[model samples]
Target: MKEIVILGAGYAGLSALHVLQKSSADIHITLVDRNDYHYESTALHEVAAGTQSGEKISYPIMDVVNPKKTTFLQKTVEKINADEQSVLLTDGQSLNYDYLIVGLGFQSETFGIPGADVNALEMVDVKTAAKVYEHIEAQLKEYKTSKDEASLRIVVCGAGFTGIELVGSLVENTKHFAEIAGVKPEQIEIYNVEAADKILPMFSDKLGQYAINHFKKWGVKLMTGKMIKEVRPNEVVYQNGKDGDLESLHAKTIIWTTGVSGNKIVGESGFEERRGRVMVKPNLTDPTYDNVYILGDVAAVMDPASNRPYPTTAQIALKMGHYAGKDILNQMSGKASTPFSFKSLGSVASIGNTHALGLVGKAEMTAYPASVMKKVIADRSLLKTGGLKEVFAKGRFDFYH
Candidate 1:
């Protein structure tokens, strides 16, 4: 049997596993991940803000594993020897594969910002996301005793998708935070700092304005056009406007949502990469190895229309995983594999559980309608990675109050 080794059990890896495990092909699958559970990276914002528990967004990797064709290994991948078609694990076990799928996900990128890694909390996975909430709660509880106003303040660095979503969740939980600190919800200040003048640049200006309006209504401080220069303990120093004057936002909770770099293993493996992302061929295979497929955040598939890589999202990752599976099977059957392609359905940003804004196809959505669509999109993602069982268990069906 051909040995197929899949690394990382995130959306892309699991999606590929789901497709491969169903087939009766003469292949044995090895699924490797450090964690035994697969969590929705998209919903990590909710986990960080205490709006959702870590368990709510994650499910066991074994739940979807078909033992007859697949074996799950909880091992951290150290490096990939593409020349030998082998992977070295941290535990000293080397996995040799006839075919390989690399879906190792992202890591926090500080872009060389001073003290960013040490000072700011990161919501990379279930544990880190949960740590954010733990830190937030601890700060709030500290405010009750220390009566420090900074304890009630939250500064989210970067107003990108994750930052905006996290800000929304934080705003949603402000009342609970206020109660803990013996203050009003309005007194819990939430700031979203972004260097870009236009936040959510992927969406239309109108949709972006819609989110900004709601944030303003919810008392969130939007610090657009301010570039974060450094993250200090209980403070975020930023460059203010054209003059480049450095200013600081002092808050007890500083969450880093600036951006992410792909897995370090990619670079360490000696594949030509930028920020841990490989520019794969049209078939989604490594340029140097036809049998090795790279997907998810670590793989950069260029969009010919814009001459830039498509934004790394769960949607594209799923498509890449599915396509990789089909292409592998085709190759096994002695057929020509097709090139991978993707067209986005749309994108949505939830301001809170009740408010959202985005475009669905060509249609614009806002408020309750957009919120419902957001839940539906999340449900679709759940259905894709975890199937009906997981959907029923962790699906977002909170459409109405």
Candidate 2:
């Protein structure tokens, strides 16, 4: 029997498992992850913002595992010895594989800013995301006794996709936070700090401005073009644009949503990588070893049109996962595997439960319509990974809200 070892129970890894479990290919699969549950990476912002519980976005890993053909291991991966076809676990066990799929997901990228990693809260996984809301609540609780206005201030360190959505979710929960602090909702100030003058550069100016208008309407202070210099305890230091004036914003809650890089294990395993991402071949295999597939955030597949790697998104990750499983099956059957290709349907950003903005194909979507599309896309992803069971259990059906 062939031994297939898949690492990380993320979107890419789980999607691969979903495909392989139904096949009678004389193969035994071992799925491994540090956590026993799989959460939607796209919905993490909601958890961090206290708009949704962590359980709402996550499901147990064993729920989708086909026990007859697949064994789930809840262990942390220390490193991968690609040349030896083995993976080392942090618990000091080594597992060998005939075919390996590496989809270890991503971590917060601090960009080497001083105190960013130490002081700023990172919402990379379910635990950390939950911690963010817990910390925010603690701050609010403290404000009731301390009466420190800083306890009500929230500073999100970046205005990227995740940061923007997080700001929206946080805004949605302002009343909840305000109730805890015994203050008016407007007293709980939220700020988004970004280095770029332009937000959502991937979308048109009109779409970006539409989001900005909502931020303004909702009382979210936008501090664009400010390069974050450092994150201190309850404060963020930044440089004011090209003029380079240093200023600091004090907040009780500081969220680091600046950016993310692939799992560090890829580089530690001797793969050629830049910022934890490997530029893989057209078939999504490691350039050095055909039997070793690297997908998700770790694999950098080039976009022929742009001559640059496509942005890492759950949409691309799912495609990569499905392609890897299919390609492996093809090779086992002595059939040629085809190069992977992807054309994005579009991208959408939800400001709050009821508001959103983006493009669907060539069509522009905004307001309630875009919000509905975002939920539909998320439900589609859940369907792909967790099937009908999870879609009904944890699906976003509150479209009217």
User: What is candidate 1's lDDT per residue for 243-278, written digit by digit as tens?
Assistant: 789999899999999999999899999999999999
Every model's TM-score: 0.98, 0.99
Report the number of the highest-lDDT candidate. 2
Which residue runs does candidate 1 get wrong by more than 4 Å? none
RMSD of each candidate relative to the true structure? 0.9, 0.9
Q: What shift in Å separates residue 113 of candidate 2 from its native position after superposition?
A: 0.9
48: Cα error in model 2, Å: 0.6
Model 2 C-alpha RMSD to native: 0.9
What digit string (tens of lDDT, one per residue) describes model 2 on residues 1-401?
Answer: 89999999899999999889988899999999999999999999999999999999999999999999999999999999988999999999999999999999999999999999999999999999999999999999999999999999999988888999999999999999999999999999999999999887778889989989989998999999999999999989999997888999999899999999999999999999998999998899999999999999999999988998999999999999999998899989899978999998888999978899988988999998999999999999999999899999999998986
Displacement of the residue 103 alpha carbon in candidate 2, Å? 0.7
